[model samples]
Target: MLSRTLLCVAFASASTPLLADTVWLKNGDKLTGTIKVFDGGKLLLNTKYAGDIPLDWKEIKTLESDQHLLVKQDATTGEISKSLQPAEDGKVTLANGDAPKTVELASIQQIMKPKPVVTDLVWKGNIDAALDFQRAENDTDDYNIAFKTSATHGQWRHNAKGEYNRESQDSLTTTNNWDAEYSVDRFFTDKWFWDGRITYKRDTIEDLARQRTVGTGPGYQFWDDELGAFKVGALLNRTDFEYSNGEKDNFYSVSGTWDYNRYLIGKKVEFFTNGEVGKPISGVADYSLETEVGLRYKVTEWASLNLKAEKDIISGSDNGDLDKTRYTAGFGVAW
Candidate 1:
């Protein structure tokens, strides 16, 4: 019923001419013109003197204009509808009033179509070292030596981290857990951004755990320039944690992120700080306000190294004894 309603509004409506609208039918043919399709697969495409060609297809290709050097065709039958909902990532969601499929504009050829820049594209990378000391420095306190590296492009970011943490004053030592992760984000305008994450985390404390999270809420770009920009955004990451202890906990975070960096000398100075004051929204969970700061140097225009230090201030009614500080130092090269 929803699909039919949208199809009526999309295809049943009277449309002016669309400039260079193109459609390629499933039978191995491409049509350049304006097209409107109903829920039952009925399609109307209009092109110059050739008139409107009614079509029915099992599937549909893209609707594009201006590419094939077909600009002379002119938009006489329908006005390119700005009606197509534009996404922040600058792409059309291709909602023919039917099941929606996301399409990235960067990969698509620009048409007379409207592609709104829904989300800003961001690219970043860093390597840093941290020095950490446990509060008790006793037999059970986690002591550490660490290393970390990360690089990110567009909506995706990846990180690899490792460390050596000792339990107690025992000569017995344990290797820091090895960790790797991938994360992505989508911006839905109106100061709203959605984050999706996938992780494989291994470390001394938790052994091995794969976590997933979706963070979304109000966000803004405070500053953007060669020096740095302040981004003040609020978000909530609903997370699922599967620990090596054969235990499961679900946590949600109401957090804020602040990131800024600039060049210093021939190197670069990068700083990122994120804090989340949150408690487990479900099940039995650990809560903490986590933060990390770092400075990185660019060896060349393509390489960088950094030192990072982090502190977790645990203060909920359930986590008074679980306090710890951690650090890591590392570097990376990128193209």
Candidate 2:
């Protein structure tokens, strides 16, 4: 009886199978793991021992899995299929337990695992803060905190951002500014979108106590890819402002905005700039412009070091020298 029990245990151990996705490399290396994603020239693989490994897609000669994945080469050619067979001569065969389909290596843009449960909405963003204090002969303090969050579902996206800044010297506040904005973008085509935004702002240092703006416009994407993207738009804005000098003003404005961002060093470092220009039809200022240029270097998956410079310009205002420039360097986190 003891011998039969040992034999049964041995049979069970031998029959238990190990299931994994497989990748064949150009240099005759084989990797077995759970394939997570193929995006931006890289493949993310989750393994039992190594946690997560990022492999260059160019180095992979072929991939195979029993799992179903969605593959896309262009706008119209996309399908969900079972597995990828090994590559021969820079092409791979996809097997869906039926007749195999072959595709070129270079034409593939994205590969995603099909989820058992459908999920449409996704969220991503970043936040950063900076602080500086000096307590020598004269005490000084400065700080800024900002966060941006975005969500996307199907052809629609929503973004929200907030920022706060303050500065003081010798127990006297020299600067204070804060702003919050919410925006929505609806994509009608690949490169064109319609956007609407609402913004609330306050600046005690600029002698503007409060400002509110609502705008809507069309935007165009010049290019959006793995490396970077550029977008520009124009909006007709209605703004209401209250100044410290007991002046309350409201007017319409023509506003233009530009946003550009690029990634470097395998997407660990990023350079970005976003700016806005506003010309009031009948208000206290002829023109108002604000721009921010920044660099973010990723320290890890969640943390990064960031440096930023900001310039705010206002022309033809009744207030004296409302223009300002500031620089900040600090750390940030993202998920």
User: Global CA lDDT of candidate 2, please?
Assistant: 0.83
lDDT of 2 at 71: 77
Q: For model 1, how does the per-residue alpha-carbon lDDT over 105-216 read when each residue is reduced to its tens digit? A: 3333212222233122223344333334454545434444444443323333343444444454444454345444444434353224455444344445543344555666
Q: lDDT of model 1 at residue 57?
A: 31
Model 2 lDDT tens row, 170-254? 9999989899999998978667899899999988776778989999999987865445568899999999878888888788999
